[model samples]
Target: MGKGDKKSKRGKIINGTYGTRRKRKIKRKPSIEEKINVEKKK
Candidate 1:
């Protein structure tokens, strides 16, 4: 069981997603340079 499972112990499921949010970890954090580049293209 994961964090979501523990929270929804009553068998209730979290909406708007296929999985739980609490268990989801950040895969990456883009650098400041990347952010600026995206804006410049627009």
Candidate 2:
């Protein structure tokens, strides 16, 4: 049960694109420490 799975609204003035504006779900770059830990895990 998620947004992408939902059907688009009919006859809407402004259609949502990628749902980025509605929610800031963009992924930020990982810190230097985090990158090192991830590499160690592998």
Top candidate, metric lDDT: 1
Q: What is the TM-score of each candidate against the true structure?
A: 0.37, 0.38
lDDT of each: 0.56, 0.54
Per-residue lDDT tens digits for candidate 2, residues 1-42, read: 244443333212134543423454669999999999999999
In model 2, the runs with Cα more than 4 Å from the true position are 1-26
The C-alpha local distance difference test score for the whole of candidate 1 amounts to 0.56
Clashes of each: 0, 0
Best-matching candidate per TM-score: 2
Q: Give the TM-score of candidate 1.
A: 0.37
Cα lDDT tens digits for candidate 1, 1-42: 543564453322433233352355569988999999999999
